[model samples]
Target: MTPLTGGVASDIASLKVGDARYCVKFALPKLKVAADWRAPRHRNAAEYAWLEVAARVVPESAVRLYGRSDSAHGFVMEFVTGAETYLWKTALLEGQPAKGEARAVGDMVGRIHAASAKPNFDRSFFWNRDDFRALRIEPYLSFTAEQHRHLAPQLHDLADMLYDSTQVLVHGDVSPKNILIRHGRPIILDAECATMGDASFDPSFCLNHLILKAVHLPAQRTALYDEVAQFWRAYAPHVSWEDASDLEARICRLLPALMLARVDGKSPVEYLGTPRREQVRKLALPLIGNPPATLSDFVQTLTSRLKELDAWQR
Candidate 1:
């Protein structure tokens, strides 16, 4: 078995049985971060169920589940590796941003949300919010609120709003690191935080990564910005369960908080240097205080600040 390295909340390894290769994942009670972060191991079951749901909605976009082990608190899935598949995060970090793949990801996520939000859809199995709160709300928003008392009210409000929302099934961790591209289609992994919650979290979670990647790789910012636009444009049309405008408003409000979370929350992005971290703070704080009402407005505000920072550095 070869252990996979990027995940924090679980132990992931590539295992081969005879000629078949499979991926095995076991939930960790305590996340592999420096912080004293922990969550229930039952999230492994939730992730397995989430993959099943995604496969039903968008078969091509979800990893094929092989089997699950209740006692072991882990599951086996198709080990997807070939010349055709590559980690999206690694590609973006290496400056290989693909607009097509971004659009595909948006489409896949949107389809899953739309399908799950239907009146006849059965999502009771994912009704529990404990895992989502333990993994996402507390660490990403509530914890950050504790660190920045001045932003506590707004951060806490966002946390409450997200925790209380029950409109659709959320993947909960849609960052680039959990995505793999195979022949231009996105294969989503890591749904340990999946739950019936705010749909805004998925897109906001994803865009946060793209925005941070741009911040880290300034030379690739323009391309990444286009990728961001493609993703939102593709995803927005599927917001049929609620007012698309209202959802976008929530996303705009939530985006900056997520941005701040990456730098100050329990799971800070590892690639950013100290200067870039400060830049994230500068960009995220004001926006969190007075969030934009639209995604375009948020992007505009972000781009303007990025340009100003670039000029100041010169």
Candidate 2:
């Protein structure tokens, strides 16, 4: 078995049993570095549950879950191989341009939420607010607010909105690292943060990564911006909720807060320098203070800010 290093919440390894390779995972009771964080061990079960649900709703984008370990607290799934399969994060860092893959991400997320918006999906097993607070809210939002005391009210308000909303099923960690692309199709991986929550969290989380990536690889800013636009365009039509406009307004507010959190939070993006982080904050702070009327307006404003920074310059 070879250990994989991309994830932080779980123990993951690639194993070959006979001719088949499998990705095995074990959720830890506590995050390895921050033992005091109090992450739940049962997240393994939560992820497995999400895999089961997603496989039914969006099979093309979901990995097939094999089964749980006979004796251990873990599960097994197909280990996707070959050069065709690429981590979206690695592709961005290496300057590989996207070709409508972001749209696929948006489409799949919409499909899952559209199919699972019922009042009886048994979220009781994974109604894990404290777990989410410890791993995500505290370290990402609240801790960042502590670092910038002035932003506490904004951050806390956003956090309250997230915890209060329970409109649809959400795949919490929808960043590039969790998306795998093969032959132009996106396969989502890692659902430890999966639960019943605000549907906006999924796309907003993803857009945050794209914004950060634009800052990291300034030369690819235009391409990344187009990708973000593509995601929202493909995603919006599938939102069957009556209050789509309100949800989008919420996403616009949440998106910039998440962007700021990534820079000032516990797990700041590793590649962002002081200048890049400040550039993100320049856009993020204003949005958090007074958000745009729509997602399109947010994109337009973000694009303008990126251009002001001359992000396309070499």
Candidate 3:
């Protein structure tokens, strides 16, 4: 068995049984981070349930589940290799921001949300908001709020709003690191934070990664921006459960707070240097206080700030 990296809340490994290879995952009670972060191991079961629902909704975009072991707090699933698929995060960091793959991801997420939002859809097995708060809300928003005292009220409000709102099932961690691309299709992984919560969190979490990548790789800013646009375009049409404008407004408010969370929260993105970290703070602070009314306005403001920073450096 070979251990997999890039995840914090679980122990993931590639395993082989006879001629067939599979990926096995075990949830950790204590997250592997610099902070004293811990959560319940039952989230492993929640993740498995999420995969089952996602596969039912979008078969092509979910990893094929093999079996799960509740006693061991682990599950087994399909093991895709680099020969068959590439990690989207690797490709984006290497300057290959494939807009097609981004759109595919957006479409898959939208379908899942739309399908699950139906009144008859069963969600009893996914009432795992405590796990969500332990993994996402507390660490990302609340922890960051603790550090940034001035933004405490706004950040806490965002956290409460996210925790209280329940529209559909959310694939909590939608960043590029959790996505694998094969033939322009995106297979999403890591649904430990999956719960019936604010739908905006998924899209906002994704777009935040693209914005962060643009910060880390300034040369690829335009390409990443286009990729973000494509992703939003593909997702916006699926906002049938609520007003698209209202959802976008929530996303705009949450996105910048999420931006700050990545920089100041428990699990900071490892690639950003100190200067770039400050850059994120400068860009996110004002937006959190007074977010744009629309996503386009937010992107335009972000683009202008990046350009201004470039000129200042020169």
Stretches of model 3 off by over 4 angstroms after superposition: 82-84, 97-99
lDDT for every model?
0.91, 0.82, 0.91
* Tens-digit per-residue lDDT, 1-314, candidate 1: 99989899999999988988999999999999999999999899889998999888887777888899999999999998899999899999999747487899999999999998999988877875878999999999999999999999999999999889888999998988899898788989999999999999999999999999989998998888888889989998998998888888888899999999999999999999998999999999999989989877887898999989978878
**lDDT, candidate 1, residue 255?**
93
What is the clash tally of candidate 1?
Answer: 0
Question: After aligning candidate 1 to the native by TM-score, how far in Å is the CA of 278 from where it should be?
Answer: 0.2
Q: For candidate 1, which ten residues in a row score worst on lDDT? A: 94-103
Give per-residue CA lDDT, model 3, range 5-91, as digits (tens): 888899999998899899999999999999999999999998999899988988777778999998999999999766658999999
Note the clash tally of each candidate: 0, 0, 0
After superposition of all CA atoms, the RMSD between model 1 and the true structure is 1.0
Per-model TM-score on C-alpha atoms: 0.98, 0.93, 0.98
Per-residue accuracy of model 2 over 248-270 as CA lDDT, tens digit each: 88888888888988888777777
